[model samples]
Target: MEIADMFSTTTIPFSGITLEQVVLAVIIAVIGLIAVKVIASAFTEMLGRTSRLSALIIELLVRFFSILLYVILVLIVLATLGFDVSSVVLGLSAVIGLILGFGLQDTVTNLASGVWVAAFRPLDKGEYVEVNGISGTVTSVGILATELLKPDNTYITIPNSQVWGSAVINSTRMDTRRLEVKVGVAYDSDLTLAIRVATDLMKNDERVLPSPEPVVVVTELADSSVNLSLRAWTKTADLWGAQWDLNREIVNAFADAGIAIPFPQMDVHLDGTH
Candidate 1:
């Protein structure tokens, strides 16, 4: 008898709804939640397979669909339980709008900015960029933030709103980059020999592009030395490595060629007038 009583349908107090209706509502809600989860997973997988869609866009789509599906499921459950689902939906919409407008304004702003970023890409994943004074390689752009992997392998997260508003400098956009190296030579050193040594050093480097024909010229004549400006063109990918290698090699080559690389020195005759 007790076992049968446990399954018996009884009227819930205060409301016209039966206990069986409440139980059915709970069961249906659970099933709907599971269905929503499955749908969300499928949609996310589909978006993931599409190469053109950005990560932020995919995330937003999945979340939007999930929320819509759950809201519909809730309304169905409420209607089945003999409640006025229409009034509930209207009230929820109004309340949610007010809450979002007042409390979640930042979230709304970030979402809007995220959409802008996905549509007009100022930066892309795997590219090196400087935004908001922090320079790093971008890993992913998401609905709320942009993730960056710094040189030290630490991760940085910047809000989408901040990123969209700040200055963005993308270093990897160009195919070729110009490298400038300045070296000061002793005033007595043969300026012609210094220029030739620097130019040959740059030309010999396979990483340096030949079309530009690396230039070496006197940029400034200082009090103690003459500064030779060495400008070379190289593929952007090889610029840093080439710059480091050429800088060291130029110093050594200058020494070997008897070109005197000068240091800051001030010559003063004991000023008796002072």
Candidate 2:
């Protein structure tokens, strides 16, 4: 018998399904699978172009889209095979519910919080942030947890729930940071001359930003000295270095110009009668 003739004559045992229909179903399922893979790859590549999208969000999106595609493909295949879609969906739901009910509450919560973190983006990798009372540089933001690299080079992982629930402070988000240093000069020294000296030093420093202009003013007048406040702005990367360098320059300049930074001292006078 010819192959075509045999396929036409063949019938599934005790059912109306034919050999030809079975072959067609197999072909359709194979094509559907191939289409799903191609679509998934394309979708991922498209997401890669969006620079603002985080890796966590990209992973979540790929999983969601792939699952949706597979579910639709399954339903189409079932309908083509003369099966009731509603019945199959209902049976599948029951199985899924059973799995969900078996202690998946925490997992679901964490997954949801992970989605929230990826969507809102309170902090990004490489940013210096303080969250949940812990300060560190964000190393990675995973679906379940966020990794932080501490100043001491130690890694700390915090669950998505805790990070999302607590307040987040991102210090590195700004382009520039302001730092203030205070120095005390003897009360008798010329305050105007002192301010000019500090201002010149700050302006000459390459790290100091010139737009806002550095400020030097007398903030306090104590018993022995006048407290000078030097407020300057620098790029975030140079903040600490600039502050340290400017402080040393101020002290040296003050000493060269006869400005005395005195320690706390008091004089006592006594009179004796014979």
Clashes of each: 0, 0
Q: Write the per-residue lDDT of candidate 2 for residues 1-274, one digit (tens) a residue.
A: 6999887678899876678777877888999999999999999999998656877688668877998999999888777766789999999999878877997676677778878988988988789999978899988777678889999998999988888888999888899999888999887888888888889889999999997999997888887789999999999999989999988888999888887889977778877774
Candidate 1 per-residue lDDT over residues 1-274, each given as its tens digit: 7644654556677887876678889999999999999999999998898656876567667777898998899898998798898899889989999999889899988888888887778988888999989999988888788899999998999999998998999888789999988899999998888988899999999999998889998989898789988899999999989989987899999999999887789887897897
Quantify how close model 2 is to the true structure by its C-alpha RMSD in Å. Answer: 7.5
Kindly report which residue stretches of model 1 are placed more than 4 angstroms away from their true locations once superposed. Answer: 1-92
C-alpha local distance difference test of each model: 0.87, 0.86
Worst 10 residues of 1 by lDDT: 2-11
Cα lDDT of candidate 2 equals: 0.86
TM-score of each: 0.76, 0.63
Task: Judging by lDDT against the true structure, name the best candidate.
Answer: 1
